[model samples]
Target: MKDDKKTDKPLKRQETEKTQQLAEHTADSTGELMNTNHGVRINDDQNSLKAGERGSSLLEDFILREKITHFDHERIPERVVHARGSGAHGVFKAYKSMSGVTRAHFLSDESLETPVFVRFSTVAGSRGSTDLARDVRGFAVKFYTQEGNFDLVGNNMPVFFIQDAIKFPDLVHAVKPEPDNEMPQAASAHDTFWDFISLMPESAHMIMWLMSDRAIPRSYRMMEGFGVHTFRFVNAEGVSNFVKFHWKPLLGVHSVAWDEAQNISGKDPDYHRRDLWDAIESGNFPEWELGVQIVPEEDEFKFDFDLLDSTKIIPEELVPVQRIGKLTLNRNPDNFFAETEQSAFHIGHVVPGIDFTNDPLLQGRLFSYTDTQLIRLGGPNFQEIPINRPIVPVHNNQRDGYMRQTINRGKSSYNPNSLGNGYPLQAKASEGGFTSYPERIDAKKIRARSRSFFDHFSQAQLFYNSQSDPERNHMIDAFSFELGKVQSVEVRQRMLGILSLVDKGLAAAVAFALRIPVPQDPELPVNHSIPADGNLADYDPFTVDTALKASAALSMANTVKDTIKTRKIAFLAADGVDEKSLTTVKAALEGAGAIVEIISPRLNFILSEGDEQIPVNHSLLTAASVFYDAVYVPGGTNSVATIEAEADAVHFLNEAFKHCKAIAADLGAAQVLEATYFSKKIPSEFSDQTVLREGIVVGEDPKKLADQLILAISQHRFWEREKPRKVPA
Candidate 1:
């Protein structure tokens, strides 16, 4: 049999040194004889050794015992957070040399190519949880550079819910299902969550993000990533600068509507994982540009909010992101268990140039990552695993741990020994060895929260104000829905107080939805992140109104909408569909890199008006509007009549209309659309502009209709259409 993976490709992906190294450890069982773990040939594999054909299996059968033992101990411990994940192999190429900023080999050389393994996951969900949960997405990338492995472990949202790592456990427990009931899985709509959030005013900024559309990203490829905590980049001359990393998707940021996301969760729980795998398998590689916001060491204290505060972000208006490199995910993992699952990423895995900052959350994660891996991967020698090993040869004094793959031949395991003649001696900084930056520190030993981290509401207000009208409305609805699910009325009322601090109008909107009165003046000490002494004066938080009112970068309305590349467009049709009308628009969309699938009343084939047997991708009963970016209907007498009468087909159109997806139809097939719930609200006009106005296109010319549909779909969604009323399906 031919190897499809080796031959099937449109782009000629260049192999890096790391890729070749991985191939050395990769095992291929093709054309090989089956054998035991000890390489013994097994002839009778199907049946275990028995006394008399049906007798009890013998314990002396090594083959059966070996197989059972391996199977029983196969699965490893999943991550406490980000358990449900999808990974891909790729390469990163720097746009230009950045010798002035740092001495990291990957960033200093423009021509150098570094192999990368990236894992995307949803936080606060179990391994079996649905991918459409409204939560933060983990965006981690491990760069196998020539020097060593550098991991950028971050998330889709730039800021986190807590400022310090000590509160990480409390935050996770609150977001998780209740301890007694475990009623809700993969959701934060519970009393425990609101009860915690109501008192933690420090989580204000991150709460705005969690409630926004960013939490429900359209797909992994369309999401943006950011290094939540600020880090330091020390140059060759030991000049340190504060930096924030960002991964900006080329396809642009987009998300599914809340209702549509719920429907998708029910229809396809593996939506994100499947989307990433299929895109790579079909050669439609996803791409993102590596951006960075660099601030000089002297400018760290220039911002109103603290740089060490993980809950706040350095707004784009204050510091612009510079696109420094391009990261392209071109290959899916060969084995999910061996590659994706075992691909360990940690923020502390930095090369020579990169170093940590004083971010408290970051400092705690530095210790937690190694500890977590020791248990999750079975031993301290987990780095020896093929997926986690660095491309360069490792020369360390440590040895003899569980799952250790290396065989040290020397007599000396300790440093500065004459037995091995110091064969693996450490090198100096001049010889490409890492050296810690000389940062002077003279501080107290007492445990106390930084006063600089107190002004949390400034950025929260900034984020709330930065949203577009539709986005802001969606946030209000989300807050209302989540709060309404809480059983404790006090928790809901207390949360309204937190929301009121961010924006009184937002609180009023949510109060209207929940049929609860807005808090006129809530009790004091809304922040519960205080010491047991209850001395509020010493740790009281003060609010700061930022100079900038809104940031365009904070809103998805400003994201890229120029291309419909890799967008899924559903073509609704059935028997007697107009061949010309369907093919004309389908071809135009496909030519622009859109994936068009035909949905009909029946599966397999649909007869066109010209008696042509067109292939149908999915049937009306099996397919869903939640899976597609837009919907289009072709003209044909029987097709329109049949679609209008079929309950499933009409319901599909209704759901598509309700979800704010672009809907287009040929004038002859307009009757099919008119049979839907939102037909009365549909505009009578037909033009390219109307596509943008109402997200509905109806015209006689197939070419014009196709053009309008393309424009409408490029917008991702017509959020303006759902402003007035929701179409009941």
Candidate 2:
């Protein structure tokens, strides 16, 4: 619950701290005299001290020795997961005061625009791996709130592959490149992954999300993000509620085809990284509304799924998300290594109003994060690294450790001391000090999981049942493609058995792709994950029937499609191009906020029929249609003939068509389209409905053609055309 009104407090610190911090780091470095680490300036930096001009160097050359030593040890250990990442500087502003639900200053005050640093990453990849890998994206945000730092560390997918954190290592080891050969770099198509998934029934729900188009997002700006664990929001009145966090992209949830994702990996491994950087540079800042789903503490066990299970979701149908704030990433990082790479996030980093739940996975992460940072950052003082530091001053009685940046004077490093007059005093809960909720716990200690976390397939079934036909087909193809890469026949069959438990038709589709029959009893290895002490006959995975058969929010097909903002559209034109048609359509698309890039036979520029020099964004040799949202060909006698004759140009259109993107051509340029394979397969009649379904726009008037193409682009893709009009590139 929020107050829906502004707070009385002023926001001077929240609004200006971001710029002040950036200035503190960068402004001091400007015009600084070159000096060594000891603040000694050396004039002879070019050469080391030597006995003579051509003699051997002496050990007394401190400048050269220091420079070389520093360069050799500059690198720190990378993160174990989410190693490949892109970060940006942003701000988050609450839409209204949420004082009714929480006392966290940032959320309770609507006037404050809190500074935040966000990092988006790929989970299974290394620092040098491609950004287009089909893996979960880490969507972590660090809010420099007035009280302290709050890191909303989460992922693009709402559910996880395991219910407990103990199985986290196993999951990662299976998905990572195999230890022996390490043949695959950043993929999960190998046997180890399927073998692990086949045994862990809890993985079924997350596997469905991984196999869907959600794995290959169109851009970092177009994907949805979710906090995968349930948390507690405690109000000042001593009331609590179970809360889930969400980040809904203003650009809407959209994704690339699996085929297109593979092509992008080859064409540009840093596609997402580049997209985020270029958008911020071009002033098209990426935006997402911060959303949350809150269920009263009394209603926690009212749902079929357990609230404490990380693998389960509180389907939006049960508790609708309330968009509470807006997050806008308007600035790119100043330095990649110092700002983006060194930044640290932790799930345990929270203010007073927020607290943890008994979620097993979450409880484990609270310990793992600090330990991981200590090893990776070289010290416990990693928070002093500016990027990870909060806006408010940090005061503590703890003494220095490795790489300690703070200098303390006076005795009394311990609390309750008469000397130093009891400095650095602690605050009470009434005075904004952090405190955990006092929930009574009287249960006995046990190493067993609750039976409530056993019903794993209902939500998985709910997810599969919610997908549209095109999305379902894509998932089927994804499973077939990935399982086909798995070498072990037994692993494939075991996975198929698990799939059958979710849905028969799904298993049949993938089994047919692998040229195998579906298993009669799909629950063959259901007890494979049981512990050694557990009885095989007693192992049972509860199956709870979901009251809801499907949820519209689970499918990307029902996402927002009213705008084509920031959509990249390619214009395939060459010498003697029709200036009127090309310029008119480009203006129209650009006016509607779409990015129009001209791709011709060669780079730099092209000649129009009116002898006007038209600039080209890229050449066909360098530009691939997979990098664009749509493709268009304008009419001109010479231009059309040249384009049709050029094999690469024709291939561009064909590949775009194959990827299910919108395509268009002027009526006079119809021959250019005919040169492609699918031109004859689609409807010849140019009815608006027929044209819309096929994602092909053809009209004599430039304005009319532009309008039709805009509509097609807004639809994101014509996925239905993919199955019937499969074309060659």
Candidate 3:
């Protein structure tokens, strides 16, 4: 007969001997009931302490007061950087067991579902800041894995503004509105920011991203997320791979134009937050695929740029990402203050099989995240907050601080104690304990960067070259507008000099737009040289190749495309409208998870067939086409005639067309489109035009209309139309 051991399941057989033995040693035998701080056995907690007369409250009620006091003071400090944000409860599931890559429990177990809390935010904005600001969006996730809570504190942009951690404070201060007047809130379109950018050459690449469409995302659900720093994924065999984390939105990356974004800020301050909350409430959960581009340790130095630099990205074309898991956000926070506000995410938090590198910016973050929490969250016990607390039981010698929740029952609260039988001792390295990889380190304590960290202009030039023709034009316009805002001519000239280093054509274009002379050459360097405090020689910026070709990954237009599930479409109608066209179009659009709003002369119920009616979501005075992805005018002879007479409706279609948004109309609605002189000056053509050729769609068939509208929305904007309009961007 076959051996019984050979026939049994591997894990089941092994658990009978090894896992059962371990569990027996760790299990607690006694059954117990949960109690309050006073350890009272009495029930009845729905009411507070009171006197028998019911007119006066009792003072000597310890249990009631204790419970109320604890509840009242439960809130802690919010994050200083990403103060205003929204979070969702989600589950992360691995696509397949990654045993071949890392030993991380979540990654190696496809069957396991790891609970996660993800927070998305806009930097340089206060808690009351508008949602549609042109700033970097923070994409932080806290994964409550079996081993520990792992926090991936990241941003929507892959590259950062500065290279070293020491410059982080300066970068933040400069990018934020000027300290003197604080004129601009949650924006980088100020003189101080441009001045800082002109001086700091390392910020060139990031500036390209900030000025692009990535900054003004339509919704938090549409933007991509990235872990900006290089991390290490180690296996059980002690082998490690350098990885960069990326979260690709299943809805696809999309954004509004600058003008549209500004208008959205004025109309709906809580645009992104409201969109996410409503989506969750409607059961249309947002999801993203967690991907990683891992480079084997031995192949680290093979790339042209240093992996240690945070201001650069190793293009996916070079090392394509391997998507290993997916994160689905299914629930919104129960309480904004209790969950979203008090949630803490630290970059230092990591589980076994995941580790940090000596990346200078990342090293600085490890210290900064923890240090900020102490001041902002009120105390070191911030982790004790329910939202930040791990699911696993925490036991250590460290104890006693402000808001300490756990009560130690044993006599010995310290480790290496005979009284408590040395319980809660630190686990050894072999038994699922976190141990740093044995990387050798030998360096002097010098306040200097490596030679490899220099040469900041090459990537900047590469980004400019990578852009499609229209994107490059937008960059030029951004520089012109930003420099024009600078009152100081010297600052503008200095900025032109910086642009010359990036691209001569770019500098010349900006100078022309501003009606100023382009600098003949960049100013001479004040400091002759600085040396690297290492075996490697100092980097020479002059020698570095400034002619490196464009990388496609640097361009947002080159990103993944084609899903319009979360796109917003506005239906323009009024009382006594065409019920058939409105119902058919809206139903088709919303069925695909698209949002449809009926915008009319007022926010009252508009009558449909059989006295039935649909509530007008927004009035003409309240809603603008800038707030939506597309606009449609249904067949309503009287409704279209009334709306066309109003200035707001005319302005709405003009703005939508100017931004290159898709617009559809039936036979009766065509009169409104033709009468509204929104884009009258815009020259139209079949393939392309000096205005929105893709914007106007007049038809009878619903399917054809839907296909055309989706195509126009995907194009993002009709920059071709912008040229003739002479709107100065």
Please list the residue runs of candidate 2 whose C-alpha ends up more than 4 Å from where it truly belongs after superposition: 1-12, 27-33, 42-54, 523-525, 684-692
- For candidate 2, lDDT tens digit of each residue in 1-729? 112322333555665775687668774557877789999986877888898999999998889899999999899888999999999998899999888889888998778888899999999979999988989999999998877899999999999999888888899999999999986888989999989999988999999999999999999999999989999998888789889999999989999999899999999999999999999999999999999999998998898879999999988988999999999999998889988999999999999899999999999999989999999999899998889888777888877888897798889888888898997778777677888888889999888788788787899999999999999999999999999999999889889989988999999999999998888876554846677787655455636776799999999999989888999999999999999989999999999999999999888999999999999999989999999999989989999999999999989999999999999988878888888888788665553323545688887788988988998999999899889889877
- How far is 449's C-alpha from truth in model 2 (Å)? 0.1
Q: For model 1, how does the per-residue alpha-carbon lDDT over 233-352 read when each residue is reduced to its tens digit?
A: 888899999999999999999999999999999999999999999999999999999999999999989988888899988889899999999999999998999998998888899988
Prediction-by-prediction clash tally = 0, 0, 2
In model 1, how large is the Cα lDDT of residue 606? 96
Off by over 4 Å in 3: 1-78, 526-543, 546-548, 608-612, 679-692, 725-729
Tens-digit lDDT string for candidate 3 (654-682): 78877867777765676677766653554
- In candidate 1, which residue ranges exceed 4 Å CA deviation? 1-15, 684-692
- Of 1 and 3, the candidate ahead on TM-score is 1
Ranking 2 against 3 by lDDT, winner: 2
- Pairs of colliding residues, candidate 2: none
By lDDT, the better pick of 1 and 2 is 2
lDDT at position 310, candidate 3: 94
User: Candidate 3: what lDDT?
Assistant: 0.77
